[model samples]
Target: MSPAHAGRPGQAIQIGRDYYEGPLHICDSVTSLLAHYLDLLDRGAYEVGEGDDYIGFVADPYESGFDPELLSGGIPHDVPSGLQAVLIQVNAPRSPLDLTPLAAAHLRRLDLKRRPVTDLTPIRDLPIESLAVSLHDGDLAPLEGHRHLSSLDLATNTTIDLTPLRTAPNLHGLDLSQATVQDLTVLADFPHLRYLALTASQWASLLDENKVPPALAAARLSKRDASRTEALSWAARLGLTVGASFVISGTLTSDSETGRTQ
Candidate 1:
């Protein structure tokens, strides 16, 4: 709604009667929306911190930049079409601000049990680190500019053939929990990888404790009722900030806050 189109005091502005409506008057192109949106954000129109509740709001990327896939139950599955993005907060609030839109598929929380590693493929020209494009049961096909990705969160996504990761030089963090991942040698491709969280991952067994010599960013690895000393020791050796946590006999625990390794 524009100011010039304001009808007589308190009068409703009907689309048909309100006047000729088109780009001639006001066009909501990506640029326009982005300008207003950023202004709103700069002035604090919305919260600055987000956690998990925000999903399906803006399910796609801005019309301008390269957008990634918004997967749902499986590979062929996707979120509602017209959706763009959403606003919410993660369960663990890092700051009072809630500014996470989860763009490019940075999915943090939700019910994904139904979404299994699938019979589908990843989109082309996408994969921002913040996005969560986890392939539940399939492999993410390589993109044109594969190494440009910043982060790829495929936690618990099994059946993932991360050949694409070889090209993802920009990749920094990865969450492959309970998924089918075999080697970190592929990760050697990502020299800048800092934060890594692999808890009870399918490849946990395959991971040669020696391979994960830290020197990266913060690391969080946990498994079924595990004694995190082993993982922590490896993390320390690599110079990574380690925060090991996991579930044990229905109880949740972390090595940092708790002294016992239950």
Candidate 2:
């Protein structure tokens, strides 16, 4: 059976049969969507909607024969121009995935959560507003001139040098949890930053009265061995919300101010 439904706001056009039962079939929803788009491309039907739509698929590149390069070549010839986003889940490593053919001007958002992408030079010149990718041992110099970037997630990367982010003037939110970034001073460059998440290595810098930026309103950190009293005291002094998992508005209660998790 094929999945049938109209695309909605903030929802992606999921094109896979993982949600279905029984063995994996070739003529599943993913294949159907791919075939439909391929047919449109072949017929030169270049008019589609501009309703913030996206297509997500999980398949092997070689076996599925769904080359991502087609997005920059044949797919864009028929599909709507300026497609919102595309999330490709590949089974193999980064060696097999090539994004050189994708045009960044038409793509605004991209999500490559766990993909082993070490080099970001390909999509660096594109106008991406939001991005989420794995940066383990990855170089961030390519992202320096991306002024339109507002949200970024580098939580899984370690020993990352965030000095390049100083050029990104519009960055508002950043995630660096589970990473080993020691310099909290680099964050001062982000004037519009409101939310930040850090690992145990970097969160301790917030304990210093002057280290936490005044523009920050919330922060997430691991409080396992931290002095909860001092951390909360500084957070209250800075008028910021701090937590282990998720940060929310409001100051810590007075009752739990004695080195205890509130």
Question: Top lDDT: which candidate number?
Answer: 2
Model 2: per-residue Cα lDDT over 1-262, one tens digit each: 3322222333224335663312212233456657766765666554444663743333333223333544221223343343545455653444424455455435556666646556778777666667777765677898896877877877445677878887887788788765566476778767778888775556556545256655777776655566767567646655655555445687765555576645
After superposition, the stretches of candidate 2 with alpha carbons farther than 4 Å from their true spots are 1-81, 90-97, 155-158, 222-262
User: What C-alpha lDDT do the candidate models reach, one value each?
Assistant: 0.44, 0.58
Cα shift from native, residue 158, model 2 (Å): 4.7
Report the poorest 10 consecutive residues by lDDT, candidate 1. 92-101
Model 1 has a clash total of: 33
lDDT of 1 by residue, 1-262 (tens): 2333211233222234433421111223446646756666566555434685542323223322222343321222334322222222223222222112232342222223333323223334323224453344456664324544555556443445555665666567667664566564565455667877676443344255445523365666656565667666655555656675565577766687667665
